[model samples]
Target: MNNVKVNVAQVRYREGESVCFDLVEDFSSFDLGTEILSFQAPVHVQLQVNNTSKVLLVHGKIDTKLNATCGLCLETFVYPLSLSFQDEWIFRAQATDDLLETALILDKDEIEINERIFEQIVLALPMKFICSAECQGLCPTCGANRNLAPCHCGENDIDPRLAALAKWQSKD
Candidate 1:
């Protein structure tokens, strides 16, 4: 039951408002599983909430950076996180959260806070995070990061389909 609900009574807030906080995903203390590519600068975010046309909007802003790993090279790099997101949190709706063992749903009178948004941020962590513009990435043959150095496995094996051409002489 690793659930963190912002008990409205504790925080001085209204239904339509925003809040800010310092965040930290402890690399040394937490086991985020194998899927969590990487993290940089911990994470700090500013969240804004507003009600319009009977829909509660949840917006987010990046107060810091998140260093993520490149999908190709598996090397970590700084990734700017400036989220100007707007999503409708229905008075009663379900959303996924990596931190939540169960789905998060909002009530009619609740301020509409959900850790699922954090999950969305995690999901937004680039599918292919490159360390730099000139990153060479890892060698496919030998499983070595090319950004570090060149590998001897540069020679690729010829496809068997093309091997038939080896015996075919030019017909003059």
Candidate 2:
């Protein structure tokens, strides 16, 4: 459904010719191992294919919104994701030692790009999903959400095992 057809004859024969494509694809959900990654909006892709004689360079941009949980606050929020990527595709006949090592060797003129698009999106995801910079997280003493309100627990209360460490800290 999200395939782009590049006229290999046109580009291969003519070195400077280019083609462009715009795709809007519905990818409602994807299985992310233990979690089901759901999207808040449809994925939009824009691609430009350029012929460089040796290879066909594909430049692309993807935009979408996904639901993510805040790492500290544990609240769900919509995360807007935008990513840009560039790839090279060379026909099997034109593939050299270095080109084969780096570029994708294609047997045909058509390319199915949804998998590649998804890969870029997944790699661009943040290691820690924070809703905002001001997230206060939860109180360790009472397990209360600190972002909503301040906790009334005594800050002086310390575990007995950590008391020796606290005492040592106070000395410095």
Candidate 3:
């Protein structure tokens, strides 16, 4: 019944059986956080499910575009995101006591992967968003974006810790 749920009975549950699925839909259901301005298109997911009798191995990649603000210049730009993940889903009856303590439980007939996919997307986001590697950032004195234009601030603004050394050098 879940959005991303897949019925295990529908797949071939053999030793090495594999199934592939493509998910293309809007991502409005999941909270993408404030850093993401908007989703440009549907999130495209390519997944391969492998059955190992005792467990199901899910491996896939998620692709999407997001509007993000540059941390340095605070400019909004379109950002492309591609994330890959691999995980195991074990049946509750087959899981050992130790695995039951730490592993996720698979339902009797279905496996829900909505939360897992959302979590992976969240983890894949960059800690710092920059429009480009050459971004010059804002000037500290006048709050001017150095990437756009050069500021008129003089270079005489030296660190206070080096002021004594500057005076000594001037005397020489």
> Each model's C-alpha lDDT?
0.53, 0.80, 0.77
User: Per-residue CA lDDT of candidate 3, range 71-135, in tens?
Assistant: 99988888899999887777887888876775557867666677777777779988888999999
Report the lDDT of model 3 for residue 66. 78
TM-score of model 3 vs. true structure: 0.81
Model number with the top lDDT: 2
User: How far is 83's C-alpha from truth in model 1 (Å)?
Assistant: 2.4
TM per candidate comes to: 0.52, 0.79, 0.81
- Looking at candidate 2, what is the lDDT of residue 22? 85
Each model's Cα RMSD? 6.8, 4.0, 2.9
lDDT of 1 at 15: 51
**Of candidates 2 and 1, the better by TM-score:** 2
**Which window of 10 residues has the lowest lDDT sum in candidate 3?**
28-37
RMSD, model 2, all Cα superposed?
4.0
